[model samples]
Target chain A: MTYSTMKPKEVRQLIREKKITTFTSGLCNGYAQANLAILPKELAFDFLLFTQRNPKPCPVLDVTEIGCPEPKLAAPGADIRYDIPKYRIYRYGEMTDEVTDLSTYWRDDLVAFLLGCSFSFEGPMLDAGLEVRHITENHNVPMYITNIPCTPAGVFSGPMVVSMRPMKPKDAIRATQVTSRMPSVHGAPIHIGNPTDIGIKDISKPDFGDPSTIYPGEIPVFWACGVTPQAVAMSVKPEFMITHAPGHMFITDLLNADLSVL
Target chain B: MTYSTMKPKEVRQLIREKKITTFTSGLCNGYAQANLAILPKELAFDFLLFTQRNPKPCPVLDVTEIGCPEPKLAAPGADIRYDIPKYRIYRYGEMTDEVTDLSTYWRDDLVAFLLGCSFSFEGPMLDAGLEVRHITENHNVPMYITNIPCTPAGVFSGPMVVSMRPMKPKDAIRATQVTSRMPSVHGAPIHIGNPTDIGIKDISKPDFGDPSTIYPGEIPVFWACGVTPQAVAMSVKPEFMITHAPGHMFITDLLNADLSVL
Candidate 1:
């Protein structure tokens, strides 16, 4: 089924049944898609503070109480463990496995955090006539590790990772205006032009995702990437952490515009 | 007295004296500065929804109960009348007089709203090493009447008025990030670059304030200006309306930095 015609719940049900295991980008087009980070219950408050401190990178879309599988605010009926098409299991900061479902790995001592993903704002950016470089080139948006540090809470602390999109200098300006209205989805670009100014040595070699084309008259606009928390999780080396694999996000019931400030 | 050395109460006392009746910008430095709008009780709820719908332009900092002269949340000890440095009284959408004290105009049927002002964010931006064009140029930030229509509530309606700042591309990007963290103070930019994109015809001739200089290699960034409610009040044409003068504003007791989200 085409994403443009599908509702978020219908898409989630297919993933829950193990009938669909693929990237969630472009799925349920107008709905919000979130990044998942499930940790042991003991770290809930500290992790909450971590997201609070670094709101741009780790925007708290919703947080479920300990041992809960449902994301009440973001997706009321959806089961967190089965709603996502893909899952990554990390042990001691190392990726141990990627799976289609996590029913077998479910535990009662876990806390779930649904974080704002760039997918939420990209749709608006496109509607506003702003070119998302990755979409044009059919590649992942390039991401770089920044020298900027995330405000630490407990063991969750690390440098921020930002996703870069190349746009005409004019579109870069428009993109900032469009994205600034949605604070939940890593609203607005963190940096524009001159990669070296933010400590990125090479624009071509991204730490994650495929590099898209940056043409003449276009500048690279960087946004606080959702990858920051995943990087933080790895840096902290939590005994065990579970997340959605890159590009395989958890689809939420929230409409992207509902997150708008005005 | 130097703003940094003056306490909030001292600043209020100075404003009440009618001696410091100029622009309140940069004065009472760390204390909260608000945009004032007073209307007859009949227009209060619609005005509230108008503010809720157009939050960036009309951030509701504090609302006084009908007939009450106190703003409990913003300034407990301050009186709504006679405390602001200056105010404009309007009759049937036309300003008739400007006064430093409202004691003669006080009425029990009126309600006052102290909306958050860009002045609150100016301090943080200055501290973050970003130049506020208006402050640097010693002029009011240029404001334009946008084609963007505010979500109308009841009988209150008007176009959103946005204040412009031209800055380096990187600074525009950083400004977006900085302002995004403060939802109460015109959260973020509504538009950036290409004034025509938002229906503004000319960059040099703004509908309000001094047209600022836009240096080469810089983008013109726009924030939903606090001047919106005044525009709305003019459009609605209530029997009575009062507002802070264009540059003059009300100083509240709240600290500016306390308003930052992260």
Candidate 2:
């Protein structure tokens, strides 16, 4: 059976059983998929405050109760500890291990946070008739670390990171209007044209992710990247953390349309 | 000088000095006004989580660092303790005192939260040429406690409180479009037409503010009220809590337009 046509619960169950241990992209099409960030209860409040202060870079989808694995609002019955296809363990800023299940690592003081991914907005942008350059080029969306400082909360503090997608000026305007309706996902383009204005030294060499081709007459439109919270959290060097490995996301029951405000 | 034309900083200065101790309705006209809620650090995480879960009713504008008096993002260099016209001190869900400054009651564990008030959207509604019944009649916006329960966070859960404005069916649609762009303030109506559908018993008598006239062709429109957080927080009956008394609010340096997503 095609994964895109399956229910979110079915996909989650498959992942939980370790039968589907690949990246979650294109699975459960039309449903929202979220990035995962799990921290000890000690860092949850500061990390939550960090997301609140830098909302564009870090739009939160749901926050599980302390010590709970279920993301009650985003996906009621799903187990966050096992629902994702892959999990990366980060200890004090360094990635220590890759695991599929976190039963052994789970603690009574852990809090899991589900953050909205840019993937949620891509479908809408495509539906709006705008060609997403990275998708067209079949490469990962280019990401850069900008000099813009995010507002600090407690021990959490760092620079803003943005993902770039090149688009025509007219399409850029239309994309802004389309994504602005979905603030729960990264809302709108933070920068339109000049890359240096926000502190990107080289367009072709992104700090993370593969660089996409920027055609003539098309500008690099940037949106606050979902990588920000993870990057910032790592900068603080907390004792321990768990996150969904790259492209391996937690598929939510919510439709992409549910994130739209209007 | 007319208060409406003055700068937000100037108006806040006057309010801090106790020279203008009344409801801050028309002062700093274009700037955004916020509802205040102060709690000890012990309850800050739960309250913040509550606001996250129930964003429509309790849209957070800014949260102060624990024990800090400045709301750096909302109003830089301004003291939250004395910026508002009046504050109500609640001890275990009971009203104990109303004071202008929090200096006497301030503690190192206190954390102040500034939530978006409905006042931020009224300007856009007026600009859209819709008649706000409460503003036109010189009365407070009617508010009611609904039977719909808010999604609970630890130590915080209660029925949602909503503010009502009577308008024609067409106006309600337009108002939804107008307000949906500003989600930081309560965005869009939760209910329209019938009152009892949301558990509002009486159309004339409201739970909080004064009721406005519902015209022959007008339907009562409801938006999640800012009172939800305060009411929910008070229901938990913390040992100590503080909130702005009624119409008196914390005026922020941010313009009303700043809150708009589109």
Candidate 3:
């Protein structure tokens, strides 16, 4: 089947049947792909406040009302547990196992959060003629641990992690302006020009993903990575935390254009 | 009283008594002091949609029901007619008079809208050690009519106007991250580095306010100005409109900190 006409629910059906378990990026082109974080109902409010406070790092696309698995705003009629290509189960902040299906792990007390991913902004950036390094390289964009702190809420507190891409200063400026229109999708670049300024001691080695080539006059621009919230969630050592493993994301029915402010 | 000591309501009361009608810059330091626009009920729905559609430029803080002057969210129990240090009345979209009071002009059908202003973000910026150039220079930030077209709603349509401040590239980056947190206010710098990029022909001569000094290392940063709604309202040639004159803002009983996301 052509990727152009594939529907999100169709894609989800394949994932549920174990026919498609690979990373779900660049599929369903204009539709938004969200980061998933399922937590127990008791921790939902704190997690909600955490996202509300640290919006840049955790721009929430939708939060299923407690005990519900459906993300009404992002993806209706889709099961959160089995729709995503992959999921990671953690116990006491430690990764327990990676699974393609979560039907066995699903709990009624779990509240699902569909977070805005960088892929939403990447669409506009790619449309603007700016090359997304991750897309070009066919790999995940390099993410670095930063000195910046996420605003603490309840049990969530940790340093902000950022994804980096090298761009000419002019392109960096243009990217900032374009991304500012979509605050829900990590909004704008958190730090532009120097990675070391944000406390990334070594640009050559990222905490996540492969480092990209920074040509002469090309500056490294970093945006508040969505990994921040997931990291914060881990730091709290939530007895049971469920998140999509890196690269695999929950595709939503909503288009990326719907998130634009202007 | 010290700025840190005074409560938002107390400061608003002081402004109402004419005991404090200065810039109101640092007062009520944390709560959100909104940009005011009082328009006839006929244009209220369109104007509401205008803000809704163009949230980046004109963030609707609170809207009063027809004939009611109270902004329950921004400044409850406060008189919109007298709380503002100064007001500008426009007839057929042209400025006709400036006054300290709007008592005589207050109509039963006038709808009061409290839109978010840069002043709300200024406090957070200063708290983050980002210097707001206009505040430091003791002058209004330079504003320019942009080539960027605002989304049209009914009879409201025009170019977005932006306020510019020159800062180092790092500060501009931080400004984007900081302001992006406060979506209620005009969030983040719209453009950075070049004035001509946004169609501002001369950097020295702004369409409004005193142009400040741009030093060697400074990069010009622009933000969607609150002036946008007023400019859009004017271009449509509204029969009657009232706004806060430049620097003379409506002092709301809300703190700048109250508006911050995290």
lDDT (Cα, 0-100) at A70 in candidate 1: 82
Segments in model 3 whose C-alpha atoms lie over 4 Å from true places: B1-262
- Candidate lDDT (C-alpha), each: 0.82, 0.92, 0.80
Question: Which is superior by TM-score, 2 or 3?
Answer: 2
Better of 2 and 3 by lDDT: 2
- 1 or 2: which has the higher DockQ? 2
If the candidates were sorted by their TM-score against the true structure, best first, what order would they fall in? 2, 3, 1
CAPRI band for model 3: incorrect
Alpha-carbon RMSD of each model: 13.8, 1.0, 13.2
In every candidate, how many clashes are there?
A: 0, 0, 7
Candidate 3 or 1, higher lDDT: 1
TM-score of each: 0.56, 0.99, 0.57
| 1 against 3, candidate with superior DockQ | 1
Computed on C-alpha atoms, the DockQ of candidate 1 is 0.04
Clashing pairs for predicted structure model 1, backbone only = none
Candidate 1: regions farther than 4 A off? B1-28, B31-262
Stretches of candidate 2 above 4 Å error? none
Candidate 2: tens digits of C-alpha lDDT, residues A1-262:
4998999999999999999999888899999999999999889888888999999999899999999899999999999988998899999879999988998889989999999998898999999899998899888889999988999998999989999998889999999999899887889889999999999999999999999988899999999999999999988888999999999999999999989997
